[model samples]
Every structure is written in C-alpha cells, then in structure tokens.
Target chain A: MRELTYREALREAMAEEMERDERVFLMGEEVGHYNGAYKVSEGLLDRFGERRVVDTPIAETGFAGVGIGAAMVGLRPIIEFMTWNFSLCAYDQLVNNAAKLRYMSGGQITLPIVFRGPGGAAHQLAAQHSQAVESLYAYVPGLKVIAPSTPADAKGLLKTAIRDENPVIFIEGEVLYGHKGPVQDEEYQIPLGRGEVKRTGQDVTIVAWSKMVHAALDAATELAKEGIELEVIDPRTLRPLDDRMIFDSVKKTNRCIIVEEGWPFAGLGAEIAYRIMKEGFDYLDAPVVRVTGEDVPMPYAKNLEHEVFPGVEKVVRAVRDVLYS
Target chain B: MDKTLMLSLYRDMIRIRRFEEEAARSYSRGKIGGFLHLYNGQEAVAVGAMSAVEPTDYIVATYRDHGHYLARVGDMNAAMAELFGKADGCAKGRGGSMHYFDVAKRFMGGHAIVGGHVPIAAGIAFASKYRGEPDVTLCFFGEGTANMGAFHEGLSLAALWKLPVIFICENNLYSMGTPLYRTLSVEDVAVRAKGYPMAQEIVNGDDVLEVREVIRHAAKRARTESLPILIEAKTYRFRGHSMSDPAKYRTKEEVKEWMERDPIRLLAERIYALGIANEEQLKAVDEAAKQEVAGAVRFADESPSPDTATLFDDIYYEPEHHEQDEKVVPLEKRRQQASV
Candidate 1:
C-alpha cells in the first residue's frame, strides 16, 4: 500500500487506465499542457501525448458531446470538467444525449464515458461556482453518480467508472484533493453502488456520501462524547443507491440521520429519509432526521457560508435531536 | 437526368409531398398530436439529398423531420404512428413526430433543439473517421438553426477536425414567420461555411435534379477527403410551420410563384418528355406508392401499444455487474475484512 493524495490517485488511475487500454483517453480544457487545472492529471499529457490527453478549447458541450460519440464507437473517453459548476453548459449533452441514448436507442448502444471533476462548495467560490450537484445528477435515471471522499475510493471508483458501460458522473470534492489516504499499488476496483461503513456502532446509523462522510465521522466523534454511538455509512454511488445496506443498518441501530452537502429541499438526504421510512419505519426507535446544506444560493461570506453548508455542528445537532426525540 | 431515374425521383418526391399533406390533415383531425412541422414543399430536398447518399450512411435532422423520416428510413405508416403515439412507431411511440429515431437504418434522430443535432452528427462523423469507416453523416437543419452558437461551434469543429459530414441547410426562407432577411444580414446561408473554410454549394432545392447532383458531389467529397461540406437548399414550405400557424408572413402570389417550380411536377414533365414511360405507367407508379403508404397505416393501426410495465425497463443498464459482484463476500463479511 502507498499513501497518495486524492489528486495523485486520480491522475495515477487515468494514466494506468490509458496505458492498459488503447481505447481509453482523457480530454478537458487544462488537461494537457497545464496538466489539469487542479493537477489531477499532472504527468498524463507528457506520458501519453496529445491525442490521448487532449487539451480542448473552452467548449464543454462540444468536447463532452465528442466524448459521448467516441464512447458509442468503442472508445472509452474520460471527460473532465474544470469544475462541476461548468457542466451546466453541457447539460443537454449530459442530460438528454449521454443519459438517454442507450434507452432512447432501445439498448442498442452503450456509452462507456466518464464525466469527472471537482464538485460542491469550495472555499470562497460563491453562488454559481460553489453549488453542490450530487442531488441534481442523482435525480437522473440513466446516469451513475459517484462521489468519492478518500484517495483510495477516488482511484478505484474512477477506474470502475471509466470501465462502466454506462455514462458516469464521477464527482470529487475540490477540497479533498489534497487529503491523503492508503491506496493499494496493484489493480483494484471498488464496485459501483455499494456502501461502506466507515465506523460502526450500535446506537444510530448516519448515512452520508462524498465530503459529507468526513463530516459524519467528525459528528460521530463528537456525538460519542455524549454517549451517542453512531455508525457512519458512505454510499459511494448515489444513483444505484445502496438503500438495502442503510435499511439493514437502520433496522439494527433503530435510528438514522442523513448528512448531505446539497440543498435541503429535494436533496439526496430527503430521498434517504423517505427510503428509511418506507423500509425501516417499524424498526425505528425515532424518526429519521437530516442535516443538509441550507436551501439557498451558497453565499460568499465565510460566516454566511458556514451557516448555509452542513458542518459537524449541524450533524451533531441533528443526531442529538434524533436520539433525544 | 435519365428518363428512368427522373420518373423514380418524381415518384419519391410525390410520395413525401402527399404523405406530409395527409399527415397535416390527420393532425388537424386530432389523429396526431404534439408539434407537427409539415414539410410539404420541402419533400424534394429530403428525397433528393437522401437519394444521393448511400443506405449505410447516417442522417440527422431537426424537429420538422417527417419528410426526412419517410424519405430515409421508415414508411408513411411508421411515421404516422409515431405522430399518433403508437408503440409501432419508430421510437416505440415514446417520441412523437419531432423525435423520430431509427437505429437500424442509421437515421440517428430528429432532435427538438434548434442546433442540437449539429454536434451529434459531427460526433457520428468523427466516430466513422476514427474507426476508418468510409461513412458520411448528412445533418439536416432549418435556416433558423444557423443562428445558434452550437451551429458555429459544430461547423468549426467539424472543419477543424476534418470530419466526414455534409451539412444540408434547407433554407425555406422563414424560421416560423421570422424570415432569413430579419435573422441574418447575408441573404445566402452558404456564406456561413466561409468561416470554417468548408466548401459550400447553393442549390435550387425545389429542383430535385439540382439538389441530387449537388448532394452527390458533396457526399463524394465528404467520403474521400474526410472533410465537412455545406449545401444550402433554397426551398419553400407549402404548409404552415405547424398545425397552429396561420402563415401570415407571405402572400398567395409568392406561394403560387414557388409552386410553379414544384420538383415532382418538374421531374414528371421531364421524364414524360424523355419517354421514360407512358402516362398509364406513370399513374401506376403513383398508385403503387400510395398503396404502399396505405398498407403502412394499416400495419401501425393494428400494432399494439407498448406495455406500461416496460416504462421502467430500459431506463438504465440493469447492473449486469451485480451478479458478478455477488460471488464475492457479502456485506457482513466485507466489513469483517476491514478489521484485518
């Protein structure tokens, strides 16, 4: 095992995948000469040359659509958005074409493409730049939305996404890129749509994904101080939601609290809460509570930003509220 | 044009013309619903251009796609069924007139967004070139789509990458009451191709022979050079934009002037003058085309609607990897491995 940052792991995954498969390639605005805007593809362009590691013009819709078409014709393309915020320009290609082609064509075509980049609120990037889209993409049927919080999960999940037959929106938190974790050296792939329990306990189950998983762990530590032992669950893939795992865990713990970085209204937390009621309501000792980002455009000010986003305090409060109720 | 070919072209043009007319009538009678953009005078463009290309080649068109649909892949019945929202339609009735798609015949789709299909066609052409396939994609769009950013981007990218694509812009003068004069400074739509350094050809779209000859050359050049070509087919729409339009833009005299150049009649006159067939034989060909269309209508009407249970069926690939993963450790055991 080797300790690598999430950014390095992602770059390593892209390089390894490209070396292994001739059909696999990476394309984006700064992916080639600049070595990726966030350095996620630091040494890839020099290693693989320009055709495989293309530096496209500022045409997200054009390149994204090109990748989809390439994927349909047997090339497995990995398209990187500078950030998930810029994906709005390619919404039609992602939503209408990439997501619907297989079904619209009656399963005649398979789009083996991966649209990857940093997602969710980062630093002081306000409003248009700092919105979390986990719930937004998860709502689509034909896409597999995966958000990886750790370096190992980032590498393994990205490899799996590149090899996936369908188009996958691989969301990596921008702040988590510098976070290092133990990753295996050899070929390893974490299966999509599977949930992993970060820390197990018997009192309450906290379901989360991506960066919120880190917050859940922080919340779990604080909640344990008050004698509330919580089990944190990271649903690696959002679309093929691993509800069965959550349901089973909730049934055992008799309590559930969901933490999410997206907006509260119609957020992924809401879906999890609904599922918990539908499947594990009778076993619950308390009603499911949710800690989510405030339903407003993310503000630029630090204090207001902290208030809008879900943090350890909010998760702890929600967990305490659920346990006490 | 040869006597035999002219007669055949005339027959195809008339089939598309009469078929769209029937569709407009049916739509007015509530047999069809949704946005139905009739391509009455535009029949010659679709028939002429489609005839110029090979069967294995691809076609991508705009929302007003019935003429292109009947001319390329499906019969009049499947087209009508699609309009009527029947399961036997090309998209299994999920997509109405605007969203016609036939994968078997390499007819990609009728995308509703103005310039949406442009990049898709370019992508298809790129795929063909990358795969070393000698196939060209013919992307059909109205003059209105030229104003979109996608059109400029797609055309530029196609030319830059040297993709084998022929953009057939059917300039019927009006983009739903907004004429070409109002939308663009340059009257000729072919001038847009100059920005991309692509070869452009302007054809009298109402004359099937002119369109056919131009498309033939354009398709050939696209196939050989792996480059983009543009064809501006200056045609006219005989009907309203859709069923709801009053067609208040132009006078009847203008319509009459364009009708004088009706491609089907022109081709028929030329075929008869060239002694292709007697009047009786020509009538038989016309009757056969109509009968074929009538048979398709019967077939679609008799076909059953798609079952409701199937709505959730094709939404996603049903995780074939699940079965493979099941052979591994269960969730309980996997968690236990975490301890190691």
Candidate 2:
C-alpha cells in the first residue's frame, strides 16, 4: 500500500489501463502537450505518445462526438472535459448521442467510453464554473454515473469505468483532487452501483457522495461527542445506487439525512430522500431530511458562496432536526 | 462510367425515388409517424457518392436518410419497415424514420439533429486512422446544417488531424422550409471548407457521373493521404421537407423547374444519350424499381410492431460488473409502483 493524491490515483489508473489495453486512449483539451489543465494527465503524453494521449482544440462537441464515433467502432476513448462546467458546451453529444446511441440503435452498438473531469464548486469560481451535474446525467437512462470521494475509490472506480461496456459519466471531486489516501499497488476495480459504509453507527444515518462525503464524516465526528453516533454512507455510484446499503442503514438508524452539494430543487438528494421514504417508511423513527446546497444559482462573494454550499454545520443541524423532530 | 456502372447508378436512383414515393403513400395513409424526411430530389448524390466508396467505408447521414441507407445498405425491406415502425426494421424499430442504422454494414446510421452526426462521422474516421485502417467515412448533412457549430468543429478537427472523413453537404436549397438564402450566411456551402484548410468540391448533383467521379477522387485521396474534404452537392427536394409539410414556401414554377433536372430523369437521359440503353429498357428499369418498392411495402405491411413488453430492453448494454442483490428495484416492483 502507498499514499497517492486523488489526481495521482486517476493518472495511475489511466496510465495502467493504457498499458493493459492498446485501444484505450485519452483525448481532450490540454491533455497532451500542456500536461492537462490540473496536471491530472501530467507526463501521460511523454509516456503514451501523442497518439494515445491526444490533445484537441477548444471544441467539446466535436471531440465528444469523435469519442462516441470511435467507440462505435473498436476504439475505447476517454473523452476529458477540462472541467464538468465546460461539459455544457458538449451536452448534446453526451445526452443525445453518447447516452441514447446504445438504445436508439437497438443494442447494436457497445459504447466503451468514459466522460471524466472535475465537478462541483471550487474556491471563488462562481456561477458558470461551479456545478454538480450528476443529477442531470443520472436522470438519463443509458448512462452510469460515478462520483468517488477517496483517492482509492477514485482510482478503482475510474479503472472500472474505462473497462465498462457502456457510457460512463465519471464525476471527480473538484476540491478533493489534492487529497491523499493509501492506494494498493496491485490491480483492482471498485464495481459500479456499490456503496461503502465509511463509518457505521445506529443513532442516525448520513448519506453522501463526492465532496459532500467529507462534510458528512466531519459532522459525524462532532455529533459523536453528543452521543449521536451518526452512521456515514457514501454511495460511490450515483445512478444504479447501492440501494441495499442505504436501505439497511436507514432501517437500523431509523432516521436519515441526505447530504449533497447540488441544487436542492430536483437534485439527487430529492430522489434519495423519496426512495428512503418509499422503502424504509415503516422503519423510520423520524423523517428523512436533506442537507443540500441552496436552491439559488451559486452566488459570487466568498461568504455568500459559503452560505450557499453544504458544509459540516448544515449536516450537524440536519442530524439534530431529524433526531429532535 | 461503363454501361453496367451507368445502368446500376440509374437503377439505384430509381430504387430510392420509388421507395420514398411508396413511403410517402404509406405516411398519407397514417402508417408511419414522427418525421419522414424524403430524399426525393437528392437521389443522385447518395447513389453516385456511395458508388465511389467501398461498403467497408462508413456512412453517417442526417434525418433525411432514406436515400443514404438505400444506396449504401440497399435493404429495401429493412428501410421500409423502419419507416413502418416495425420490429423487422433495420434498427429493430427503435430508430424510426429519422435514425436508420445498420452497424454491421458500417453504415453508422442516420442522426436527426441537423449537424450532430458530423463529429460522429469524424470520430469514426478518427478511429479508422488510429487503427491504421484505410476505410474512410462519408458524413452527409444539408445546407442548413452549416449554421451549426458542431459541423464546423467536426470539419476543423478532421482537417487538423488529417483524418479520412469526407463531409458531403447536400445543399438541397431549403433546410426545413427556410431557404439557404435565408438560413446560410453564404449561398455556397463548399467555400466554408476554407475555414478548415480542407479541400473543397461543388458538384451538379443532377449529373450522377460528375458526383461519382468527384467522390471517387475524394475517397482515393482520403484513403491514401488521410485528408478531409468538403463536397457540396447542389441538389433540391421534389417533395416537402417531411411528410407533414405542404411546402408552401416555394413557387410551383421553382419546384417544377428543379423537378425537370431530377437525378432519376437526368441519369435516364444520360443512359439514352450514350446509347447505353433504349427507351424500352430504361422504362423496364423504372418498372422493376417500382415493383421492388411495391414488394417492400407488402413486407412492411405484414411486419409486426415492436412488443410493448420489451420496451425497457436495450436501454443499456449491461456490464458484468456486479451481481446486484438489491441495487436495482425489480421490474415487477417498479411496474407495481408505477401503477400505484
């Protein structure tokens, strides 16, 4: 076992997969010569050569469709959107072409492609650049969505996404890129649709994913002093959720709190809360509450941005509300 | 072109013309639904260009794709059944008229969005070049598609990469009721290739031989040199954009004028002018094409609609990543919940 940042873990997984399979290639803006905007693809061009680690112009729709077309034949393409915010430029290719091609073609095409990049708010970058679009992607039927919290999970899930037989939307944590954790040296893959119980307890359940997972863990640390003993769950795969883990936890805790960074209205949190209500309705001692970003399009100022985003305090207050009510 | 090649091209144009005519009849009778874009006037471009390339070469077309499929795959039953919305269709009835796909034939399928498939076609060529394959990709769209960013991006990348993709813009005058003069910034779409530093050609689509020769050279250049090219096939549609429209935008004189240069008739005149075939033989070719289309109609009429029970199938190509014990709600339970 060795320590690696989330960025290094992703680079390792891609480099390893490229070594294993010749068909796997990376293509995106600044992925090659520039060593990636965030250095996520640092030194890949030197190692894999310009052919595999391709660099494209500032054209998302073009390159995205190119990846889809390549996938249609035999090549497996890793189409990187520099940031998930920039992905809106090529949303048509992802939503219409990539997602629907498999079904629209009546299962004739096997799309082995991954659309990966950093998502969610980062520092002072406001409005356009700050967005967690997992819900929008998850709503599409033909796509599998994955958002990993830990470096280990990021590496493992990314490897799985590359090898998967369909279109995968791999949303990496924007702020968690530099976060370090121990990763195994041996080859491994974390299966999609599986959730991990990051920390277990019986008093209340706090479910989260990606950046929000850290906030939930922090909230649990503070709540434990008050004998709350909050159980933390991270459903790594957003779409085909690890439902059994969430339901089992809810049944035990008898109270649930969903934590997410996306907009509160029609967000992934709404779906998770409704599912808890449906499946664990009888077991619940209190109502399932959601700790999510404010409904407004993220504001600019640091304090207002802080107020809009979900944090440890919000999760703690949500836990208290579910417990007290 | 030789006599055999000339006759085949003539016959191919008639095949598409008759198929579209019959499909239009079926639509009038309330058989097919959704968009039904007929390639009535643009027959020469598909038949002529598809003739120049190998079947292994890829073909990606826009929503008005019946002609491209007929020219490349030439499965009249499959194409007609696709329009009929039957399970026996090329895309298993999922794609409808707008999206006709035959992956096995390397006909990448029909895309509905005006310029959306351009990049997909470029990507197909990108894959071919990456794999060291000589197969080129022919991307088909209308003049109206030139306005889309996707089209420019597709061309720009293809040229920059020196990928083997030929963008064939069938400038059929009207882009869904709006004429090119209104929709396009420039009257000629081929010159736009200058932006990409790509080779360009403008062909009189009524002349099947010229189209065949242009694509032949373009495909050769693409295959050997891996160069992208933009080809504007100056053509027009005889019918409205789709089955729904009355085509009130154009004057009867204009429609009548373009119809006189119809590729089917133009090719027949060429055949007769070259003394390749007599009037009776050309008439026989037309009759045979009509009969072939009539048979396809009968086959489509007898085919079954897709089963509602299997509606949920093919949404994803399931991967063996996990033995989901409870990850997914069972279909039966989901159905029950939906009812509730």
Candidate 3:
C-alpha cells in the first residue's frame, strides 16, 4: 500500500480506467490540456492522448448530455463539471436523461457515465458555489450518488463508477483533494450501497458522509478522551443507502446522531434521522440528533463560513445531546 | 429512385397517418394516458428521411414521434399498443406513446423533452464511429427545439467532435402554439448551422422526394466523412400541438392551406404521376394501412395493462451477483477479524 492524495487517486483512477478500456475517456472544461480546474486530471492528457483526455468548452448541459448519449452508444464517458455549482446548468440532463434513460428506455440503454466535480463548502467560496447536492441527487429514483471522504475510497469508487452500467454522480470535496490515505496498488472495487464504520464504539452511532465523515471521526477521537465512545459510520453511496446496516448500528448503539455538511431542510441528515426513527425507534434511548450546516447560504467571510458549516464541535455536541438529552 | 423503394415510402407514410389517427382516437377515449404528441402533419419528413437511412442506422425522435416510429420500424401494432399503454407495446407499456423504443430496429426513442434527443443521437453516432460502423444517427426535432440551449450545445458538440449525426429539424411553424417566428430571431432554422461549420440543407418537408434527396446526400456525406449534418425540413403540423390543444393560435384558413400541402397526398400524387402505382393500387395501399391500424387498435384493446408486482423491475439493472462474499467483515467486528 502507498499513500496517495485525493487528487492523485482521482487521476490514478482515470489513468487506470482509460488504460484498461479504450472506450473510457475524460471530457470536461480544462480536463485535458489545462489538467483540470482542481488538477485532478493532471498529466492524463500526456498519457492518454488528446482524443481520450478531452478539454471541453464552457458548456455543461450540452457536453453532459452528450456524455450520456455516448454512454448509451457503448462508450464510457467521465464528465467533469468544474463544481457542483456549475452542474446546475446541466441539472436537467443529469436528472432527466442520465438518471432516467435506463428506466425510461425499459432498461434497454445503459448510461455508464460519471458526472464528477467538487461539492460542498470550500472555505469562504460563498453562496453560489458552496451548496451540497448529495442529498438532492440521492432523492432521485435512478442515480447512484457517491461522496467518499478518503483518498483510497475515492479512487476505488471512481473506478467502479466508470465501469457501472448505471449513471453515478461522483461528488468530491474541494478541501479534501490534498488529503492523503493508503490505497492498494491492485485492481479493486468497493461495492456501492455499503457503509464503512471508521471508528467503533458503544455509546452512540454518528452517521455521516463526505466531509462530515472526517468531522465525525475527529469528534469521536475527542469524545474518547472523555470516555464517550462514539461509532462513526460513513455511507459512501447515498442513493442505495445501507439502511439495514444503519438500523443495526442504531439498535446496538441505542442512541444516534447524524452529521452532514448540507443544510438541515431535506438534507441527508434528515433522511438518516427519519430512517432511524421509523425503523429503529424502539431501540433508541433518546431522539436522534442531527448536526448539519445552517439553513443559510455560505458567506464569503472565513468566520461566517465557519459558522455555516458543521464541524467536530457540532458533531460532539449532537452526540452528547442524543446520549443524555 | 426504384419503384419498390418509392412505393415503400408511400406505404410507410400511409401506415403512420392511419396509426396516428387511431392513436388520437384511443387517447380521446381514455385508452391512453400522459402526453400524446401526434406527428399528423409531418409524415413526409419522417417517411422521406427514413427512406434514405440504412435499416441498421440509428434514429432518435422527439415526443411527437408516431410518424417517425412508423417510418423507421414499420411496426404499426406495437406503436398502437404503446399509445394504448398495453404491456405488449414496444417499450412494454413502460414508455407509452411519448417514449416508444425499438432496440432491434435501432429506433432510439420518443424523447419527451424538447431537443433532448440531440445529444443521444450524437452519442449513438460517436459509438458507431468508434466501433468502425458506417451507420449514421438521424436526430429529429421541431423548429422550436432550435431555440433551446440544448440545441446549441448538442449541435456544437456534434460538429466539434465530427460525429456522424444528421440533425433533422421539422419547422412546423410553431412549438406547441408559440409560433417559431415569434420565438426565434432567425426564422430559417438552417441559418443556426452557420455557426457550426457542418454541412446543412433546407428542403421542402411537404415534398417527400425533396426530403429524400436532402437526407440521402446528407447521409452519404456523414458516412464518408463522419461529419455531422443538419437538415432543416420546412414543414407544418395540420393538427393542434397536442390532443388537448384547441389550436386558437392559427386560423382555419391557414390550416386548410397546410392541409392542401399534406405530405401523404404529395407523395401519393408523385407516385401516381410517375406511374409507380395505379389508382386501384393506391386505393389498396390505403385500405391495407387502414386495416393495419384497426388491427393494432384491436391488439391494444385485447392486451392487458402491466401488473403492479413488476412496476419497479427494469428500473435499475438487477444486481446479478447479490450473494455477499462469506469472508466479508462486519463493521463492528472488522478490527477483531484483522487482528485474528
């Protein structure tokens, strides 16, 4: 095993997949010659040639839909939107065509495509660029929404997403691109719809995903000093949620807290809380608490941005609230 | 053109007209549900263009797809059953009329959203080129779709990639009652292609022969160069935009004028004048098409609706290998297993 940064892992995944299949290609704004806005696709143009690693114009809806069509025709297309903010322009293509084509075509067409870009708050980026859409896309019927917190998970999951016969939304956090983790140098796939418990404990279950997973893990480490053992669970895939695993975790822990980096209204945390209440309510010792971003647009100021996003402190508070009150 | 080929186009157009008439009736009688976009007045465009396309070539069309469906596949019964929402339909009743698909015929779909199929058509063409297949993708949409942002993106990408796609625009004067002239600054839809550097042709959609000639040349160009082409078929829709439209936007006199230039009649006259078919033979073709429509209606009426038990099936590809590996570790016990 070797340590790889999230951006390096992403580039590795693209490089490996493109090498494995001639049909696998990268296309996005600045993905080819410019090496990606976030440098996730750096050096791919040199290795895979200009035809495969394509640099697209600033046209999200058109290129995104074209990727879907190409996928339908038997070429695997990895579409990179610069950020989740820009994906809004191509939302119709993502939701209407990419997600629904397989189902609407009665399963005749397989949309083996991945729409990837940075998601959620990246310090002081402000309202237009900082919204999280993991929960929004997960609510749709025909899509796989993935937001991995670790570098190893990002590489493995992206490889799987490119090979998947259905459409997958690969969400990356801008802040976590430089974070490093140990990844095996062998071919592998982490199956979608499985949860990984990062830290095990007995007092509470902290269900989180993406950046919140890291926050929850940090909160667990701090709570350990106080003798409050908190279990932190990361659901990499949101659409095909591991509900049974979640229910079982809640039943064991007896109390639960959900941490999310999105707004409280109709957020992923709300869904988690609802699921725990509906399925494992009798096993709960207290109400399931949610630690989530404030229900307001992220501000440009660093202090205000910190106030908007959930952190270790918020997760720790939520854990104590669920356990005691 | 060969006599057989000319008669085949005429027969397909007649079949589509009769099938759509039945579909419209079925829809009005509460047999079909959801949006029913009729291609009543735009038969010549589909008939003529589809005539030039190889059977293996791909075709993608908009929600107003009944005419395109018939012209492409010549499967009247399935089209009618689809409109009737029967389980035996082309999409197995899941797609209904607005989303008809025939994979074997390479007829991609009846896309609901305006200009939505443009990208898909490009994709199919890209795949064809990737696999070294000489087939082309004929993408059909109305003049109204030209004004959409998707149209610009789809066409631009198709041209930039040099994908073998023929973007067929049926300028039916209106996009569901919003007249094209009112919405688009450039009334001529073909003028939009000036920006893309792709081969473009404008033809009389009222004349099936002219459409045939334009598409034939475009198809040849696409097959040889792998270059995308745009064909703007100047046509009109005789009926209201949908089954529900009162058609208050246009006068009865205008409707009468378009009706006089009916695509089917134009093809019929051309065929008769060329001595391809006598009056008696043309009458037989009309009778046979009517019978085919009646049979399709009967098939749809006799077929059953989809069972609720399987409503969620085919929605996602079934996970073929669901048996978890016996060596998989549970989250709570993963550390213990690792230590062991």
Using TM-score, give the best candidate's number.
2
Backbone clashes under 3 angstroms, per model: 0, 0, 0
Tens digit of per-residue lDDT, candidate 2, span A81-155: 999999899999999999889778877888999999999999889899898999989888888899999999999
Tens digits of lDDT, candidate 2, B307-326? 66546556667643124323
- Chain A vs native chain A, TM-score per candidate: 0.98, 0.99, 0.98
Best-first order by TM-score: 2, 3, 1
Judge candidate 3 against the unseen true structure and give its global Cα lDDT, from 0 to 1.
0.85
Task: Report DockQ per prediction, comma-separated.
Answer: 0.32, 0.67, 0.46
Alpha-carbon error at B3 in model 3, in Å? 1.6
After superposition, candidate 3 runs with Cα above 4 Å error: B321-340
Report the poorest 10 consecutive residues by lDDT, candidate 2 chain B.
Answer: B319-328
**Superior by lDDT: candidate 1 or candidate 3:** 3
**In what order do the candidates fall by lDDT, top score first?**
2, 3, 1
Which regions of candidate 2 fall more than 4 Å away from where they truly are? B319-340
